[model samples]
Target: MSDDQSPEPQIFETLQPADLASRVADQVLRAIGDGRLRPGEKVADARLARELGTSRAPVREGLRLLESQGLIVSHPRRGFFVHAYDADELKEVYDLRECLELHAAEAAVARMTKADCARLEAQVQKLYDLADEGQTQEQVVQDFAFHRMLCELGGNSRILRLFDQIAAELRAGIALVGQLYDDPEEIARSHDPLIKALRARDPARLRAELHEHLQDAQIHVVQLFRTGAFDLTNLDKLSDDQRNRLLR
Candidate 1:
């Protein structure tokens, strides 16, 4: 190698105004998680623009981003609406989730460091803390983060990407449908089994624990959809405080 060889010049394209779109998209997700937005509700981008203090273009783009992720849907002339989930749609998502995470858990146990296991333990403990406080929304976010780590630790780029693609819908679903149990600790403590399996470095146990956990969630979420629990909730009310709290 020639030390004096000229290096290729870095070419950078002008960045698009995607940050605003992403910010708007994040606020929309927060609102959905907060129960300010729900299934089958119209998403008025104009109102969101005023709430976000921007033009409608970015708001529309943001909703489009979510639509790509299956959280929002567009109608012919009626603007956008929150995607109304049913049992069948949920079944597909959960089935895919099981297929991915079970294998990911097996791979994770094979490659995870002690520090990695410790990090997982800390996250699980945080779930207990959040559950104790009865912060359902925060618990939903934390729960998603905990399971998302499985794919991250698994060290498979494709699996991680796929998980991310479905993540927006997954997070929204968890937030909207909520837990089946009145006892938050039940769901929080359920993760303990996964940690135990991981600590032992037993792939079979890890997969079994993860499978059962996901299966339980699948059953719970599908039942919620079947019973139309979320159909009547959060029809239309984007409060200033909710938007500000979410966006800011």
Candidate 2:
């Protein structure tokens, strides 16, 4: 461990332009996912380039990619900013999610096999474990993964692609209010009914369960908006109990 002792060589590999852009996009997305970059925050290309150890070109390319994904929006002269979360907009997004998921649920129930059910069950367990571990971001990801797997089980490429289109917004919505749930374990267990319906191969029951689940989420998000709990400035002023109850 002498000062002059040779250090382990770092592994370095060159990334193609597209790969670099994708990598930058992923880092920015991860920042958003973890709440480091909140809704409506400006994403300056030069600043992000400095932080990411690249140039403005790749950062601009990444911002363009994120813009296409509905995670960020560009203005005429204001550059790019994270997409703001609006209750009304979220309601519309949830409406679309419901339509897509209900259709997928029916189709999936008809075709789900033992192996598919097992994979879903494992995802549910991961959700529970992540909740207990207080890994809120990962929990949101696992929750969506469970539903995305359901859509995949339907064996419809187009429907899966459609889901992917809204995936970022969906994740953002969850990350925004994920800590507000009264009981994380209860939230994790909510998927049980859907899984049970899938196991029984009952499309009608599965559709009903899925609809109820999404409706509950919609209600919660709307309630949070109405209560003004997403105001980051006010959040710090709230009491511990209030904060936990509002954002958990």
Best TM-score among the predictions, by candidate number: 2
**Candidate 1, residue 2: lDDT:** 89
Judged by whole-model lDDT over C-alpha atoms, candidate 2 comes out at: 0.74
| Alpha carbon lDDT of each predicted model | 0.75, 0.74
Number of clashing residue pairs, candidate 1? 0
Name the regions of candidate 2 deviating beyond 4 angstroms.
1-24, 49-58, 125-141, 176-181, 231-248
Candidate 2 lDDT for residue 183: 70
**Per-residue lDDT of candidate 2, residues 1-248 (tens digit):** 89999975422223345577888887777666545567899888767776666778888998899998788999988899999867888778878888998998788877878898899999999989988997665566567678888888888889888887676566435544565576777768999998888888888888888999999988787667756665554333334433222221
Best by lDDT: 1
Number of clashes recorded per candidate: 0, 1
lDDT for 72 in candidate 1 is: 92
RMSD (Cα, Å) for all candidates, in order, is 13.0, 8.0
